[model samples]
Target: MRISLICIGKTDESYLNMGIEKYVNRLKHYVNFTLTIIPDIKNTKNLTQEQQKSKEAEQLLKQINATDTVVLLDERGSIFKSIDFAKYLDKKMISSTQHLVFIIGGPYGFDNSMYDRAQSKLSLSSMTFSHQMIRLFFIEQLYRAYTILRGEPYHHE
Candidate 1:
Protein backbone atom coordinates (compact mmCIF):
# COMPACT_ATOMS: atom_id res chain seq x y z
CA MET A 1 0.00 0.00 0.00
CA ARG A 2 1.13 3.53 -0.73
CA ILE A 3 1.63 6.00 2.14
CA SER A 4 0.98 9.69 1.62
CA LEU A 5 1.76 12.48 4.08
CA ILE A 6 -0.36 15.50 3.29
CA CYS A 7 0.58 18.68 5.05
CA ILE A 8 -0.98 22.12 4.50
CA GLY A 9 2.07 24.38 4.24
CA LYS A 10 5.63 24.29 2.96
CA THR A 11 8.72 23.89 5.11
CA ASP A 12 10.66 27.02 4.21
CA GLU A 13 13.85 26.26 6.06
CA SER A 14 16.43 24.49 3.94
CA TYR A 15 17.69 22.37 6.83
CA LEU A 16 14.24 21.12 7.71
CA ASN A 17 13.45 20.43 4.06
CA MET A 18 16.71 18.52 3.73
CA GLY A 19 15.91 16.43 6.79
CA ILE A 20 12.41 15.70 5.50
CA GLU A 21 13.80 14.81 2.09
CA LYS A 22 16.32 12.44 3.62
CA TYR A 23 13.65 10.38 5.29
CA VAL A 24 11.39 10.53 2.27
CA ASN A 25 14.18 9.11 0.14
CA ARG A 26 15.05 6.45 2.71
CA LEU A 27 11.37 5.44 3.00
CA LYS A 28 11.30 4.55 -0.69
CA HIS A 29 13.11 1.27 0.11
CA TYR A 30 10.22 0.10 2.28
CA VAL A 31 7.01 1.75 1.05
CA ASN A 32 5.66 4.01 -1.63
CA PHE A 33 5.85 7.26 0.32
CA THR A 34 4.78 10.63 -0.96
CA LEU A 35 4.95 14.02 0.75
CA THR A 36 2.28 16.34 -0.61
CA ILE A 37 2.18 19.93 0.51
CA ILE A 38 -1.08 21.72 -0.07
CA PRO A 39 -0.52 25.37 -0.87
CA ASP A 40 -0.99 27.86 1.95
CA ILE A 41 -4.33 29.62 2.05
CA LYS A 42 -4.29 33.11 0.60
CA ASN A 43 -5.15 36.31 2.45
CA THR A 44 -5.15 34.93 5.96
CA LYS A 45 -5.55 38.44 7.40
CA ASN A 46 -9.08 38.59 6.07
CA LEU A 47 -10.06 35.21 7.48
CA THR A 48 -10.79 33.97 10.94
CA GLN A 49 -8.98 30.95 12.37
CA GLU A 50 -12.01 28.77 11.78
CA GLN A 51 -12.32 30.01 8.21
CA GLN A 52 -8.65 29.29 7.56
CA LYS A 53 -9.04 25.76 8.88
CA SER A 54 -12.23 25.23 6.89
CA LYS A 55 -10.44 26.32 3.74
CA GLU A 56 -7.48 24.05 4.51
CA ALA A 57 -9.91 21.22 5.25
CA GLU A 58 -11.46 21.59 1.81
CA GLN A 59 -8.06 21.34 0.15
CA LEU A 60 -7.03 18.39 2.31
CA LEU A 61 -10.27 16.53 1.61
CA LYS A 62 -9.67 16.91 -2.11
CA GLN A 63 -6.41 14.93 -1.85
CA ILE A 64 -7.95 11.69 -0.65
CA ASN A 65 -9.74 8.92 -2.50
CA ALA A 66 -12.94 7.43 -1.13
CA THR A 67 -11.14 4.12 -0.74
CA ASP A 68 -8.15 5.66 1.03
CA THR A 69 -7.64 5.26 4.78
CA VAL A 70 -7.35 8.76 6.26
CA VAL A 71 -5.36 9.29 9.45
CA LEU A 72 -4.90 12.70 10.95
CA LEU A 73 -1.76 13.68 12.88
CA ASP A 74 -3.67 15.31 15.69
CA GLU A 75 -2.32 16.23 19.10
CA ARG A 76 -5.36 14.74 20.79
CA GLY A 77 -5.09 11.43 18.91
CA SER A 78 -3.75 8.12 20.15
CA ILE A 79 -0.02 7.96 20.86
CA PHE A 80 2.09 4.88 20.24
CA LYS A 81 5.66 3.83 20.94
CA SER A 82 7.94 3.33 17.91
CA ILE A 83 7.88 -0.44 17.92
CA ASP A 84 4.15 -0.49 18.49
CA PHE A 85 3.78 1.95 15.63
CA ALA A 86 5.59 -0.53 13.39
CA LYS A 87 3.16 -3.21 14.54
CA TYR A 88 0.29 -0.85 13.88
CA LEU A 89 1.58 -0.32 10.35
CA ASP A 90 1.93 -4.07 9.89
CA LYS A 91 -1.69 -4.43 10.93
CA LYS A 92 -2.81 -1.92 8.33
CA MET A 93 -0.76 -3.64 5.63
CA ILE A 94 -2.25 -6.96 6.68
CA SER A 95 -5.73 -5.45 6.36
CA SER A 96 -4.98 -4.56 2.71
CA THR A 97 -5.35 -0.83 2.83
CA GLN A 98 -4.97 0.57 -0.70
CA HIS A 99 -3.62 3.98 0.30
CA LEU A 100 -2.85 5.28 3.76
CA VAL A 101 -3.09 9.03 3.97
CA PHE A 102 -1.82 10.91 7.05
CA ILE A 103 -2.60 14.59 7.20
CA ILE A 104 -1.10 17.52 9.11
CA GLY A 105 -3.63 20.29 8.92
CA GLY A 106 -3.03 24.05 8.80
CA PRO A 107 -2.14 26.34 11.71
CA TYR A 108 -5.51 25.95 13.38
CA GLY A 109 -5.71 22.20 12.73
CA PHE A 110 -8.52 20.28 11.04
CA ASP A 111 -12.14 21.22 10.54
CA ASN A 112 -15.10 19.15 11.68
CA SER A 113 -15.69 17.63 8.25
CA MET A 114 -12.08 16.54 7.99
CA TYR A 115 -12.30 14.90 11.40
CA ASP A 116 -15.58 13.28 10.41
CA ARG A 117 -13.98 11.81 7.28
CA ALA A 118 -10.94 10.30 9.00
CA GLN A 119 -10.72 6.57 9.68
CA SER A 120 -8.28 7.12 12.56
CA LYS A 121 -6.09 9.73 14.25
CA LEU A 122 -2.48 9.45 15.40
CA SER A 123 -0.43 11.71 17.61
CA LEU A 124 3.32 11.85 17.24
CA SER A 125 3.57 13.27 20.74
CA SER A 126 1.58 14.94 23.46
CA MET A 127 4.24 17.67 23.41
CA THR A 128 3.67 20.23 20.66
CA PHE A 129 6.05 21.03 17.79
CA SER A 130 5.92 23.65 15.11
CA HIS A 131 3.92 22.67 12.00
CA GLN A 132 7.02 23.01 9.77
CA MET A 133 9.16 21.01 12.17
CA ILE A 134 6.51 18.29 12.47
CA ARG A 135 7.09 17.32 8.84
CA LEU A 136 10.69 16.37 9.58
CA PHE A 137 9.81 14.68 12.87
CA PHE A 138 6.96 12.69 11.38
CA ILE A 139 8.95 11.60 8.36
CA GLU A 140 11.87 10.53 10.52
CA GLN A 141 9.51 8.60 12.78
CA LEU A 142 8.00 6.95 9.75
CA TYR A 143 11.44 5.92 8.55
CA ARG A 144 12.30 4.72 12.04
CA ALA A 145 9.14 2.64 12.16
CA TYR A 146 10.07 0.96 8.90
CA THR A 147 13.58 0.28 10.15
CA ILE A 148 12.23 -1.19 13.37
CA LEU A 149 9.97 -3.37 11.28
CA ARG A 150 12.98 -4.57 9.29
CA GLY A 151 15.29 -4.95 12.31
CA GLU A 152 17.57 -2.19 11.12
CA PRO A 153 20.04 -0.44 13.45
CA TYR A 154 18.92 3.13 12.83
CA HIS A 155 16.72 3.36 15.86
CA HIS A 156 17.80 2.56 19.44
CA GLU A 157 15.66 1.51 22.36
Candidate 2:
Protein backbone atom coordinates (compact mmCIF):
# COMPACT_ATOMS: atom_id res chain seq x y z
CA MET A 1 0.00 0.00 0.00
CA ARG A 2 1.07 3.56 -0.69
CA ILE A 3 0.73 6.33 1.90
CA SER A 4 0.47 10.04 1.19
CA LEU A 5 0.17 13.15 3.36
CA ILE A 6 -1.85 15.95 1.81
CA CYS A 7 -1.59 19.19 3.74
CA ILE A 8 -2.64 22.77 3.09
CA GLY A 9 0.11 25.34 2.43
CA LYS A 10 3.84 24.89 2.05
CA THR A 11 6.39 24.62 4.84
CA ASP A 12 8.07 28.05 4.97
CA GLU A 13 10.54 27.48 7.79
CA SER A 14 13.86 26.09 6.60
CA TYR A 15 14.44 24.16 9.83
CA LEU A 16 11.05 22.49 9.69
CA ASN A 17 11.52 21.68 6.02
CA MET A 18 14.85 20.00 6.74
CA GLY A 19 13.37 17.84 9.48
CA ILE A 20 10.36 16.90 7.36
CA GLU A 21 12.62 15.92 4.49
CA LYS A 22 14.72 13.67 6.70
CA TYR A 23 11.71 11.66 7.79
CA VAL A 24 10.38 11.48 4.27
CA ASN A 25 13.67 10.04 3.04
CA ARG A 26 13.74 7.47 5.85
CA LEU A 27 10.11 6.51 5.14
CA LYS A 28 10.92 5.76 1.48
CA HIS A 29 12.91 2.71 2.63
CA TYR A 30 9.78 1.13 4.10
CA VAL A 31 6.80 2.35 2.07
CA ASN A 32 5.82 4.63 -0.79
CA PHE A 33 5.34 8.00 0.93
CA THR A 34 4.89 11.50 -0.41
CA LEU A 35 3.89 14.89 0.99
CA THR A 36 1.81 17.09 -1.29
CA ILE A 37 1.05 20.69 -0.30
CA ILE A 38 -2.00 22.50 -1.56
CA PRO A 39 -1.54 26.19 -2.07
CA ASP A 40 -3.19 28.51 0.45
CA ILE A 41 -6.26 30.40 -0.61
CA LYS A 42 -5.88 33.94 -1.96
CA ASN A 43 -7.69 37.04 -0.64
CA THR A 44 -8.64 35.21 2.52
CA LYS A 45 -8.77 38.48 4.49
CA ASN A 46 -12.15 39.24 2.94
CA LEU A 47 -13.54 35.75 3.04
CA THR A 48 -15.29 34.12 5.97
CA GLN A 49 -13.88 31.06 7.69
CA GLU A 50 -16.39 28.87 5.89
CA GLN A 51 -15.45 30.34 2.54
CA GLN A 52 -11.77 29.70 3.13
CA LYS A 53 -12.50 26.12 4.09
CA SER A 54 -14.64 25.67 1.00
CA LYS A 55 -11.78 26.78 -1.23
CA GLU A 56 -9.45 24.36 0.55
CA ALA A 57 -11.98 21.61 0.21
CA GLU A 58 -12.11 22.11 -3.54
CA GLN A 59 -8.35 21.74 -3.77
CA LEU A 60 -8.35 18.70 -1.47
CA LEU A 61 -11.02 16.90 -3.49
CA LYS A 62 -9.12 17.41 -6.73
CA GLN A 63 -6.16 15.38 -5.42
CA ILE A 64 -8.26 12.39 -4.38
CA ASN A 65 -9.02 9.28 -6.45
CA ALA A 66 -12.08 7.06 -6.28
CA THR A 67 -10.15 4.20 -4.72
CA ASP A 68 -8.06 6.23 -2.30
CA THR A 69 -8.72 5.82 1.43
CA VAL A 70 -9.14 9.25 3.00
CA VAL A 71 -8.12 9.86 6.60
CA LEU A 72 -8.32 13.31 8.10
CA LEU A 73 -5.91 14.49 10.79
CA ASP A 74 -8.58 15.93 12.99
CA GLU A 75 -8.30 17.19 16.54
CA ARG A 76 -11.20 15.04 17.76
CA GLY A 77 -10.16 11.89 15.94
CA SER A 78 -8.75 8.62 17.21
CA ILE A 79 -5.21 8.67 18.59
CA PHE A 80 -2.93 5.62 18.48
CA LYS A 81 0.48 4.69 19.83
CA SER A 82 3.41 4.05 17.47
CA ILE A 83 3.15 0.25 17.73
CA ASP A 84 -0.58 0.32 17.17
CA PHE A 85 -0.09 2.54 14.15
CA ALA A 86 2.40 0.00 12.80
CA LYS A 87 -0.21 -2.71 13.20
CA TYR A 88 -2.80 -0.54 11.48
CA LEU A 89 -0.44 0.05 8.57
CA ASP A 90 0.33 -3.67 8.41
CA LYS A 91 -3.35 -4.44 8.18
CA LYS A 92 -3.75 -1.98 5.32
CA MET A 93 -0.85 -3.58 3.51
CA ILE A 94 -2.21 -7.05 4.17
CA SER A 95 -5.59 -5.92 2.89
CA SER A 96 -3.90 -4.57 -0.25
CA THR A 97 -5.06 -1.00 0.09
CA GLN A 98 -4.07 0.89 -3.04
CA HIS A 99 -3.60 4.43 -1.73
CA LEU A 100 -4.05 5.71 1.81
CA VAL A 101 -4.28 9.49 2.04
CA PHE A 102 -4.06 11.47 5.29
CA ILE A 103 -5.03 15.12 5.01
CA ILE A 104 -4.13 18.09 7.24
CA GLY A 105 -6.55 20.90 6.66
CA GLY A 106 -6.05 24.67 6.56
CA PRO A 107 -6.13 27.18 9.42
CA TYR A 108 -9.90 27.10 9.59
CA GLY A 109 -9.95 23.33 9.22
CA PHE A 110 -11.95 21.28 6.70
CA ASP A 111 -15.37 22.03 5.37
CA ASN A 112 -18.42 19.84 5.83
CA SER A 113 -18.01 18.39 2.35
CA MET A 114 -14.47 17.28 3.11
CA TYR A 115 -15.61 15.65 6.33
CA ASP A 116 -18.29 13.75 4.43
CA ARG A 117 -15.69 12.35 2.03
CA ALA A 118 -13.31 11.11 4.70
CA GLN A 119 -13.26 7.38 5.53
CA SER A 120 -11.63 7.88 8.92
CA LYS A 121 -10.05 10.50 11.18
CA LEU A 122 -6.84 10.30 13.22
CA SER A 123 -5.47 12.57 15.90
CA LEU A 124 -1.75 12.82 16.49
CA SER A 125 -2.27 14.28 19.96
CA SER A 126 -4.84 16.02 22.11
CA MET A 127 -2.85 19.24 21.96
CA THR A 128 -3.00 21.49 18.91
CA PHE A 129 -0.03 21.97 16.59
CA SER A 130 0.90 24.29 13.76
CA HIS A 131 0.44 22.91 10.26
CA GLN A 132 4.14 23.14 9.48
CA MET A 133 5.13 21.47 12.74
CA ILE A 134 2.56 18.73 12.26
CA ARG A 135 4.19 17.87 8.93
CA LEU A 136 7.44 17.03 10.68
CA PHE A 137 5.83 15.27 13.62
CA PHE A 138 3.51 13.13 11.49
CA ILE A 139 6.26 12.02 9.13
CA GLU A 140 8.57 11.18 12.02
CA GLN A 141 5.84 9.14 13.66
CA LEU A 142 5.36 7.27 10.40
CA TYR A 143 9.07 6.49 10.29
CA ARG A 144 8.99 5.33 13.91
CA ALA A 145 6.01 3.10 13.19
CA TYR A 146 7.89 1.43 10.35
CA THR A 147 10.96 0.89 12.51
CA ILE A 148 8.82 -0.64 15.24
CA LEU A 149 7.22 -2.97 12.72
CA ARG A 150 10.68 -4.09 11.56
CA GLY A 151 11.74 -4.72 15.18
CA GLU A 152 14.42 -2.06 14.89
CA PRO A 153 15.98 -0.35 17.94
CA TYR A 154 14.87 3.10 16.80
CA HIS A 155 11.73 2.95 18.91
CA HIS A 156 11.70 2.21 22.66
CA GLU A 157 8.81 0.85 24.68
Candidate 3:
Protein backbone atom coordinates (compact mmCIF):
# COMPACT_ATOMS: atom_id res chain seq x y z
CA MET A 1 0.00 0.00 0.00
CA ARG A 2 1.08 3.56 -0.66
CA ILE A 3 1.03 6.23 2.05
CA SER A 4 0.58 9.94 1.50
CA LEU A 5 0.57 12.93 3.76
CA ILE A 6 -1.64 15.75 2.52
CA CYS A 7 -1.07 18.77 4.70
CA ILE A 8 -2.71 22.14 4.23
CA GLY A 9 -0.41 25.14 3.60
CA LYS A 10 3.35 25.19 3.19
CA THR A 11 5.63 24.97 6.15
CA ASP A 12 7.44 28.30 6.35
CA GLU A 13 9.83 27.35 9.11
CA SER A 14 13.15 26.24 7.67
CA TYR A 15 13.99 23.92 10.54
CA LEU A 16 10.65 22.19 10.32
CA ASN A 17 10.93 21.75 6.56
CA MET A 18 14.39 20.24 6.90
CA GLY A 19 13.23 17.81 9.55
CA ILE A 20 10.20 16.78 7.50
CA GLU A 21 12.36 16.19 4.44
CA LYS A 22 14.76 14.04 6.44
CA TYR A 23 12.03 11.62 7.45
CA VAL A 24 10.36 11.67 4.06
CA ASN A 25 13.66 10.50 2.56
CA ARG A 26 14.14 7.86 5.24
CA LEU A 27 10.56 6.60 4.85
CA LYS A 28 11.23 5.74 1.21
CA HIS A 29 13.19 2.71 2.45
CA TYR A 30 10.09 1.26 4.10
CA VAL A 31 7.07 2.27 2.04
CA ASN A 32 5.93 4.25 -0.96
CA PHE A 33 5.38 7.67 0.63
CA THR A 34 4.41 10.99 -0.86
CA LEU A 35 4.00 14.48 0.57
CA THR A 36 1.47 16.77 -1.03
CA ILE A 37 1.00 20.32 0.16
CA ILE A 38 -2.28 22.05 -0.48
CA PRO A 39 -2.07 25.77 -1.03
CA ASP A 40 -3.58 27.96 1.64
CA ILE A 41 -7.00 29.38 0.93
CA LYS A 42 -6.92 32.59 -1.02
CA ASN A 43 -8.40 35.91 0.10
CA THR A 44 -8.69 34.68 3.65
CA LYS A 45 -8.76 38.24 5.01
CA ASN A 46 -12.43 38.55 4.09
CA LEU A 47 -13.64 35.11 5.08
CA THR A 48 -14.92 33.67 8.31
CA GLN A 49 -13.45 30.57 9.92
CA GLU A 50 -16.18 28.40 8.43
CA GLN A 51 -15.75 29.91 4.99
CA GLN A 52 -12.02 29.28 5.09
CA LYS A 53 -12.63 25.70 6.13
CA SER A 54 -15.06 25.25 3.26
CA LYS A 55 -12.44 26.48 0.81
CA GLU A 56 -9.79 24.28 2.37
CA ALA A 57 -12.22 21.39 2.26
CA GLU A 58 -12.56 21.74 -1.49
CA GLN A 59 -8.82 21.37 -1.92
CA LEU A 60 -8.63 18.48 0.50
CA LEU A 61 -11.38 16.62 -1.31
CA LYS A 62 -9.61 17.09 -4.61
CA GLN A 63 -6.55 15.31 -3.20
CA ILE A 64 -8.59 12.24 -2.30
CA ASN A 65 -9.79 9.33 -4.40
CA ALA A 66 -12.76 6.99 -4.00
CA THR A 67 -10.38 4.16 -3.11
CA ASP A 68 -8.23 6.12 -0.70
CA THR A 69 -8.44 5.57 3.04
CA VAL A 70 -8.07 9.00 4.62
CA VAL A 71 -6.92 9.47 8.18
CA LEU A 72 -6.98 12.82 9.90
CA LEU A 73 -4.68 13.87 12.73
CA ASP A 74 -7.32 15.06 15.12
CA GLU A 75 -7.23 15.90 18.80
CA ARG A 76 -10.22 13.72 19.55
CA GLY A 77 -8.80 10.70 17.75
CA SER A 78 -7.32 7.53 19.16
CA ILE A 79 -3.98 7.81 20.91
CA PHE A 80 -1.48 5.02 20.39
CA LYS A 81 1.90 4.19 21.83
CA SER A 82 4.87 3.84 19.47
CA ILE A 83 4.71 0.04 19.44
CA ASP A 84 0.98 0.10 18.92
CA PHE A 85 1.47 2.57 16.11
CA ALA A 86 3.91 0.17 14.50
CA LYS A 87 1.26 -2.53 14.73
CA TYR A 88 -1.28 -0.13 13.29
CA LEU A 89 1.06 0.62 10.44
CA ASP A 90 1.48 -3.08 9.84
CA LYS A 91 -2.28 -3.49 9.83
CA LYS A 92 -2.74 -0.75 7.26
CA MET A 93 0.01 -2.20 5.11
CA ILE A 94 -1.68 -5.57 5.32
CA SER A 95 -5.27 -4.46 4.69
CA SER A 96 -5.15 -1.27 2.64
CA THR A 97 -6.63 -1.55 -0.80
CA GLN A 98 -4.58 1.10 -2.60
CA HIS A 99 -3.54 4.28 -0.84
CA LEU A 100 -3.68 5.57 2.73
CA VAL A 101 -3.89 9.35 2.97
CA PHE A 102 -3.10 11.11 6.23
CA ILE A 103 -4.15 14.72 6.52
CA ILE A 104 -3.00 17.59 8.71
CA GLY A 105 -5.52 20.37 8.55
CA GLY A 106 -4.95 24.10 8.71
CA PRO A 107 -4.81 26.17 11.89
CA TYR A 108 -8.59 26.45 12.11
CA GLY A 109 -8.93 22.68 11.56
CA PHE A 110 -10.89 20.70 9.00
CA ASP A 111 -14.35 21.20 7.61
CA ASN A 112 -17.22 18.78 8.09
CA SER A 113 -16.59 17.15 4.73
CA MET A 114 -13.05 16.14 5.69
CA TYR A 115 -14.23 14.56 8.92
CA ASP A 116 -16.81 12.62 6.96
CA ARG A 117 -14.28 11.33 4.44
CA ALA A 118 -11.70 10.04 6.89
CA GLN A 119 -11.64 6.29 7.64
CA SER A 120 -10.10 6.98 11.03
CA LYS A 121 -8.61 9.68 13.24
CA LEU A 122 -5.29 9.55 15.10
CA SER A 123 -3.97 11.81 17.82
CA LEU A 124 -0.25 12.21 18.45
CA SER A 125 -0.77 13.66 21.85
CA SER A 126 -3.21 15.56 24.04
CA MET A 127 -1.17 18.74 23.58
CA THR A 128 -1.76 21.05 20.64
CA PHE A 129 0.86 21.72 17.96
CA SER A 130 1.28 24.14 15.10
CA HIS A 131 0.46 22.91 11.61
CA GLN A 132 4.04 23.57 10.48
CA MET A 133 5.42 21.68 13.44
CA ILE A 134 2.99 18.80 13.04
CA ARG A 135 4.44 17.99 9.62
CA LEU A 136 7.90 17.40 11.06
CA PHE A 137 6.64 15.68 14.18
CA PHE A 138 4.31 13.30 12.37
CA ILE A 139 6.87 12.44 9.73
CA GLU A 140 9.40 11.56 12.41
CA GLN A 141 6.86 9.36 14.16
CA LEU A 142 6.09 7.67 10.86
CA TYR A 143 9.78 6.99 10.30
CA ARG A 144 10.07 5.67 13.83
CA ALA A 145 7.06 3.46 13.30
CA TYR A 146 8.64 1.93 10.22
CA THR A 147 11.94 1.34 11.99
CA ILE A 148 10.15 -0.34 14.86
CA LEU A 149 8.30 -2.57 12.46
CA ARG A 150 11.58 -3.57 10.82
CA GLY A 151 13.15 -4.37 14.17
CA GLU A 152 15.75 -1.71 13.57
CA PRO A 153 17.84 -0.14 16.31
CA TYR A 154 16.53 3.37 15.62
CA HIS A 155 13.75 3.01 18.16
CA HIS A 156 14.41 2.12 21.80
CA GLU A 157 12.11 0.57 24.35
lDDT of 1 by residue, 32-134 (tens): 9999999999999999999999999989989999999999999999999999999999999999988999999998888999999999999999999999999
Per-model lDDT: 0.93, 0.94, 0.91
Residue pairs with colliding backbones in model 1 are none
C-alpha TM-scores of all predictions? 0.98, 0.98, 0.97
Q: Per model, how many backbone clashes are there?
A: 0, 0, 0
TM-score of model 1 vs. true structure: 0.98
Tens digits of per-residue lDDT, candidate 2, 1-157, equal 8999999999999999999989999999999998999998999999999999999999999999989999999998899999999998898889989999999999988999988999999999999999999999999999999999899999999
Q: List ranges where model 2 is wrong by over 4 Å.
A: none
lDDT of 3 by residue, 1-157 (tens): 8989999999998988889989999999998999999998889999999999999999999999999999999998999999999899898878755898899998898899999999999999999999989888889999999999989999998
Candidate maximizing lDDT: 2
Q: What's the CA error at residue 71 for candidate 2, in Å?
A: 0.4
lDDT of 1: 0.93
